[model samples]
Target: MTASLSQLSGRVWIYPGDPDPEAVMPCVAVVADDAGSTVVDAGQSPAHARLVQSALAEAGLPAARRLVYTHHHWDHTWGACAWEVEEIVGQESGATLLSAEARRSWSQEYLQEQVVANPRLGPSFKARARAMTGWADFAVRAPSRTFTDRLMLSGGIEVRHVGGKHAPDSTVVAVPGSGVLLLGDCFYPPPFHLREPGPAGEEIDLRQISALVAEGFDWYVDSHSPPWRPPVPE
Candidate 1:
């Protein structure tokens, strides 16, 4: 399930999922330096987490020292506990949502309702819900660290916590040195799964993401897709 670090450019290692992309969600864990590694988002299950860990070890990078949740969705945040990291960072609002026990309970219940309403999700939805059962316990410890606007991590990696567009608390991790941007669920690739309905009449904030992409990035990393790709030139 763990792929080796083949194409090395600026010490970047990508771990692809074993199953087809449709069956398995993708995650990108980037190591800024020896001191810590910044995980873009947790995978769908513990097995994916293990694959990430194995890839990190194989690449000579440290295990996920800092876990970063792109959004507050279960698919992205459930497997976070597998890392057992000390510090989990995200946007202030997202961190707040995860911090409260009531909110966590409500979110899970809401997802369950959605599954029941749409039987297409069927057993898969229930399985995912079960996987997220322990979130109340894990999410409490998650996102111990929070940022408002932007924060600079070690190794010149800058993470900007952008809101008002995506999920009320979407954090985008940008590596200025490498020009790699980790965009969580904000502007996902094709075959996008709008798991939750958008607010009333507001559309996705493509402008914000476009502006960031315009700023200049060598690679673009999304939560639901494969490895980061080269960003279009401004």
Candidate 2:
């Protein structure tokens, strides 16, 4: 499968991820300004990162000068080293978690060992492990900068931590210049390993999510899904 870059609006572009048999990639975004572009979500591997760079080059956008992660998930942040950006930023907790993961072995055997040690991680771990090939070069890169609650960057871009059941360190990016809000995976339900298998104990904070939607963004893009326009509250 291949990924193509598409314009979401002025100053905002998206490289929609392709879900192949090997790996299910995350959607990568580009927010451009006069200085340079700030890439959101790095992708699955160096190879995946290269596809994004190629798409950017084909579109005439300069290589990303900065990378902002939505969270610390492997699908979204493993490609950080390949980005070669000047600065990489993520939420404090995510950065810490990623830093911890960077110390682990990504080999298949190690991955299987993890599952064996923690049966709850079987499904999730298996899915991620199957995506590995050139494990020797596979390295997890942590964020160079970390923020606790929110951070504002050039060109009207804002990154905010919005913890969700999917991941407590989840983040949402808002590009007001383009009216596109990158939701990352904040809306996803808790992973199977974490789920209680019953009614919601603590569902995603709709108040917070609706608050974001209430801002009237034209596009709400989440990783692994098509950009959508959620109905605005009156």
Candidate 3:
């Protein structure tokens, strides 16, 4: 099994997995520009966060003072507790979700139960949780900076609160300089399953996704899948 898969390019860095092979870990991104580096999203656990941090150091990118979130899912935000970042940015709705009580956001107990319930996730959970020191003192942090529409990062990357596809708080990180778009939890057929729909909750609308795909990108990175050219949205 692949322990971890990392890829680096002139524009972006992708650290796609955790130490464990079986866990459903989100792929984290780092976009580099003139000022410094911007972390696109946190990962599954503290260990994954460290892996991301190490990847940045290895790539010789500047220290990441800004950590951006694609959405407020457990796998994406849990690692926020691990990254020692100065500012966290996300959609206002995603920030609201994180501002909630840790349990309300995502309970460690609930996550443990989930790991135990799914045989596929068992090995990864054990490894990640152990690395996180028994998941002790699990915490969630609210984003220091929140945006309803679009926000620009150090590297000229734009993070937009483009929801209605997976979670209402879903976000898309697009780096025009690098020709990459990090679509968080973008379901293939456009899952349109939203949690707590509001201003950010818009329908996936396959046509729009197809349009974005057609716009062209050097790389499309997502949470669970390998980095590849995005197919015309079906």
Q: Lowest summed lDDT over 10 consecutive residues: which window, candidate 3?
A: 187-196
Give the alpha carbon lDDT tens digit for every residue of 124-205 in model 1: 5665655453444343334778888888877776778665444777778776666577777775422224344445334556
Q: What are the models' TM-scores? A: 0.74, 0.91, 0.75
In Å, residue 32's CA in model 1 sits off its true spot by: 4.1
- True-structure lDDT of candidate 3: 0.70
Across 61-142, the per-residue lDDT of candidate 3 in tens digits comes to 7777778888887678778888877888989988877777365523446548867677555554454454454356567777
Clashing pairs in 3: none
Q: For each candidate in the order shown, give its overall lDDT on alpha carbons.
A: 0.64, 0.83, 0.70
In angstroms, the error of model 1 at 165 is 4.5
- Looking at model 2, residue 84 earns an lDDT score of 77
Better of 1 and 2 by TM-score: 2
lDDT of 2 by residue, 36-130 (tens): 78999988777788889999989888778899999888788877778778899899998888888999877889888988999988876786776
Q: lDDT ranking from best to worst?
A: 2, 3, 1
Which ranges of candidate 3 are over 4 A from the true structure? Answer: 1-8, 18-22, 101-132, 188-205, 230-234
Q: After superposition, how far is residue 27 of candidate 2 from its true place, in Å?
A: 0.9
For TM-score, candidate 1 versus 3, the one ahead is 3
